[model samples]
Target: MANIIKKIKRKHKKKKLQAERAKMEQSRQNRTPEDAYQERLSKHRSAVIRRAVMTVVAVAAVATLFFFYMEKRSYHNYKILSASEQEDVVATNYAEMSGKILRYSPDGASLVSDTMDTYWSTLYEMQNPVADVRDDRAVIADQDGTLLEMFDKDGETGSVTTSYNIIKARVSSSGMVAAILDGGDATWINFYGSDGTLIAENQTHLADPGYPLDVAVSDSGDIMMVAYQFVDGSETTSYVAFYNFGDVGQSEDDRIVSGYTYDGVVIPQIMYLDGNRSAAIRDDGFTLYKGSQIPKEVETIKVDKEIVSTFYDDNIIGLVFKNGDKDKPYTMRGYSTDGSLKFEKKFNIPYTTIKASGGNILLYNSSQISVMNSRGVEKYSGTVDGTISDFIKTGWNRYLLVLDNGVDVIKLS
Candidate 1:
């Protein structure tokens, strides 16, 4: 009986121990995998939130910068308008020392300005100011007898042989040919490629070699010279001639004024202001020639003092003179297209002729400049500390005022 009892107890104990082992294994498997999966899910969610936050921050920063930048630029342009007293929109520094005011051309380029500034230095000292913007090229005649042609887009596009006797050098309207009159009274016009290749050269004789004061090129690239001659030992005569590059005998109109001058007077300066209009200032008064040779009536403007210069506008001509014997005061008198009296103004300072911009007249009298309306009313006046020499109209609204010391951008406001 005792042996049977021991066997039953041992079997019962083995079954209980097996049941405990199975339960522990099931719990172990469930706990390990569930905890690991939960931890992995938490880590993935944290990484996704981090990426989304960073993206939003970066986008916000870019938007802020862009908005401020645009606002700043808008304020800048508006500031230019608020500073004008007359409420006229004028741009100061329309041209730079090297940059010149040019008529708007969609095809070709030309240097259109009041006078020449030492082109060598002007071409290099361009700033980002609005005044220095131009489309014309610079034709530089250096002291070393180097003729360089620089385009607004291309630097140093062409050059020509420096005139050995270089009395006056001028570029054609197309900016392709350079006509030079040598000191030996020899004149040669050479056409060059934009790459500095010699294309053609035409040598011609001037009407009067003794006094060659002005040279001009028509819009068609025709070269002409205005020379002076002495009829008798006492009086002077003026003559004008033309050369059509190489198309010499194509027409009977090779040279007009091939005759002689009625009055023995020399022309001080000459200019072809536009296609059909021409003007010359002589010792006596200003004269206009219509269509190259047809002489118009001489417009003699009365100057209060010695007449220093006469300039031609599109429809009017102006004569500037010293006001009195003192040579300090000056007056600018305007004339109609038909030599009729337009209007005149007397200034306290000696006046220098400046180009008209935006239908307004700009005059520099010594160290002071006066801006006038088309009717000769003084709109705004400013005092320039330096001696003013030259000025150019950038357009109808702006000008580049140049002095011996520096340049000022004067806008019509």
Candidate 2:
């Protein structure tokens, strides 16, 4: 009976071990092949996504580096041209008609070529010489208007003697000269042709439109715009009158084609942008006029800031004012002939002289010069060797720099 009991126990133990082995096999078989494949596929996708993300990051880093490299390459400093010299040039002018430069001294005026060669020189007696240079011609006159000399790139064209003492004079591109003369009780505006012939003359009396503050003549010397100021009681009135001297204006009374009156505004400066367009700059703002014979007011722009300086070219007007900032000394605002504000920018450097040429604004002092385009982008800023007294644009990126020592032709690239 003991042997039988021991055999049963052995058999039961073997059966229990076999059942455990079978259960282990079944569990292993229940893990599906598809499930294992899905797990491996998910791991592969994650690896691919990680690699793509890393590639994108690498590309972005490279692109940023390239952008900075290109930006650094684009920026350039000014280069001094091979041509430089020291001269005793008192005044300088560029003639666009003949593509030459004229340097004036106490002795006379010398016309120079682009190669710095003197083409011609003329001697004359000039005291306090004021020169008006245009694309076509140049006119040099003394403060007293005693001697008026008109010349071009070739040589002297004509000379005229003023009847009254000259307050100011301007020359047009067409060689026409306009002079404002002091006539004691009244002011006289005289127009001279390129041949020194008197084209037209007018006198502004105090009893009429008061005193003539400014005068501008057309390129053809056929149209004239005058700004007059008069005080009525406690209020001051300003008038911008257009006079036509052509055949169309001969029938009109006083040859006065049109006139505009402004109360409490002083129009101190008047200019002719072209043969048809005129501008009157007042203490507050400016007014633009358009017409051939009869000028009509088309636009008016009012400025609120304190005007420090103003400049204009044939197509644009620039006003520089203080914006109450310590870092920035002045703000330059540009306007088109149609009264559109084209650009505005702040200048960090102080400038003694400001001018508008072509489509750019130039600001310079004794040691430094800066140029800003029409879009208000600073194209160039650099230190000059000596004190710059005057400068003229000889080429697109070149300038005829007149210094205290002499004149230099420089290139700004």
Best by TM-score: 2
Q: What pairs collide in candidate 1? A: 93-131, 94-131, 95-131, 98-122, 165-183, 236-264, 236-265, 358-396
| Candidate 2 colliding pairs, count | 1
Off by over 4 Å in 2: 1-76, 82-86, 90-98
lDDT of 2 by residue, 168-204 (tens): 7877767888888888888888888887888888887
Q: Over the stretch 1-413, how does candidate 1's per-residue lDDT look in tens digits? A: 99999999999999999999999878767787778788799999999999999999999999999756533331111002111122111222223323454322112233434343223222322112111121243343332243444344333566455545344444444454443445454555454544556655545454434445565554444434354444555666676544444344245454333333536656766665555456666666666655544334344433335677665555667777765645436677777666677787776644555645545576776676666655556666667556666555554445666555544455554
Error of 1 at 277 (Å): 1.3
Q: Residue 253 CA error for candidate 2 (Å)?
A: 2.2
The TM-score of predicted model 2 comes to: 0.77
Predicted structure 2: lDDT: 0.79
Give per-residue lDDT, candidate 1, residue 265: 59
Question: How big is the positional error of residue 395 in model 1, measured in Å on the Cα after superposition?
Answer: 3.8
Give model 2 RMSD, 1 decimal: 15.4
